[model samples]
Target: MAIYHLHAKVISRATGRSAVAAAAYRAASRLHDLRLDRDHDFSNKSGVVHSEILLPDGAPERFLDRATLWNEVEAIEKRKDAQLAREVEFSIPREMTQAQGIALARDFVREQFVERGMVADLNVHWDIGEDGQAKPHAHVMLSTRRIEVRIGEAVHGRRDGIPHPERGGRGAYDLAPDPGPDGAERGRRSTQAHDPSADGNSGDAARHPAEALDAGEALAAAGRTARLIAAARLRHEGLGLAQDQPSIGFGAKERSWNDKDLLLTWRERWASLVNERLAELGPVRA
Candidate 1:
């Protein structure tokens, strides 16, 4: 039988939870949390069939490294009660094969979260119970902020009529990524970085100005995602532009995300995705 279960919640420091630790546990890996000066090791943990980090199209490639991604997320937030990350867990229809299950989860995440500009750390677990049945489920740790270049109002320099020495880099600035929380260790006063408006000379499309001008339909669709991110930013900052939101993945949640209706929407979406997959496999399996 197909069971629908979707759970979402914020991981807050006020509740004594750390994103690094949560990620390590879910991925069954070891990660050194730079902010806490400690290591979260779950290398021996079991039942983790797959783990992956999904970023927006224009996001930094370096963030592919799980440890680096979460550490950078931890570095960007400067609040004791800060909402570090959002987590979603849902059940996968037991009738589906492992490969089908993986694909289903990945597709849902890419469309719902990644397309919306959120970074998602996806972990799929297949646990076997004493009844000899596999209880397969997916756990997704999502970044509250959408991926984008965050520039400060204080202009520094220019390049081709663009902000060259752009402000805002307390968080994950690929030009100069912060080493620790609040960047206090490195004296993060001015985050002067490279010319984002530069051409292919930089070799990094994520930082290049041509990114917005990309001709692909996918890239063009980023405009809608951008608006969604911006709206979330305002909601995260209490109805105004927030300067502290990082260039990294840690700030500004979509206001509607907190609404109960949104959860129902997600639930419906999940069920629809699952049913579509099952139907393709036929009624017997479904």
Candidate 2:
């Protein structure tokens, strides 16, 4: 039986590791970290089945080289504790052929990371498990920052763009919005307007914000209802007696995920792919 596991991590300078070393170890090749003035070599390392440096469609041709890729990352990040790279480790089902497995992995990486402007250095390995079985897996190293490739220019898509809104800066240069959610949910809306069932009573009730309030909204609504009931009961109990009252207001909308969300999202995506491939293969023979 094939297991489902996808892990994501960061290689940071705080951990006393460099991008060059991570790349060399995964690729089983040699790369020199010019910033640290040292060489990282793993050419004789074993169990490396395949390795490749993958870039977005319009990335500069020079970045095709692994050494150049990691070196650029090191050069871009100047902080002592900067994150050098993001790594994702996932299990590959032994049921699929080598070509199929590689193709699936690359497809997932390209769609999930590279398409969203990340340069991925991916490696596949075969190792012996504790039970003496062959365990095949793939490791993906990613760029920390968002990127975009233009004509002869590598654009760093910064989340914190120019013209600070809260800083009272002058020129508020408008930056392009992110291309929505990643992976399968990219460009997909939370609700569809063209649903046939939207005309029904249940669907209408479900879609209405007032009727379909979330946990926080429900809590606020319940508080308001309680206050109204308490006021009526007080008036009935004592027709002329009155006490101090407090004001109430609604809370803000729910907050979304941060850095950790991205990792979990990618992990779920990989798991989905594994299930898809298994379904395609159908039940295995005894």
Off by over 4 Å in 2: 148-258
- Candidate with best lDDT: 1
Q: Per-residue alpha-carbon lDDT of model 2 for 1-286, expressed as tens digits? A: 7786775555667557788888999999988998889899999998888898887766666677888888877875555655566677787987776777788889899988888767789898877788987788898987755444221111232111221112111111111121312122222221211232333535444445376777898899678767765765566457643333321111111112114455567778888898898899898776
Clashing pairs in 2: none
Worst 10 residues of 1 by lDDT: 152-161
> Against the hidden reference, what TM-scores do the models get?
0.65, 0.62
Q: lDDT values of the candidates?
A: 0.68, 0.62
Give the Å error, residue 24, model 1: 0.5
As a TM-score, model 2 comes out at 0.62
lDDT of 1 by residue, 144-214 (tens): 65565554321112111232332222222111122323233132212221233333344354445465355
Off by over 4 Å in 1: 152-256
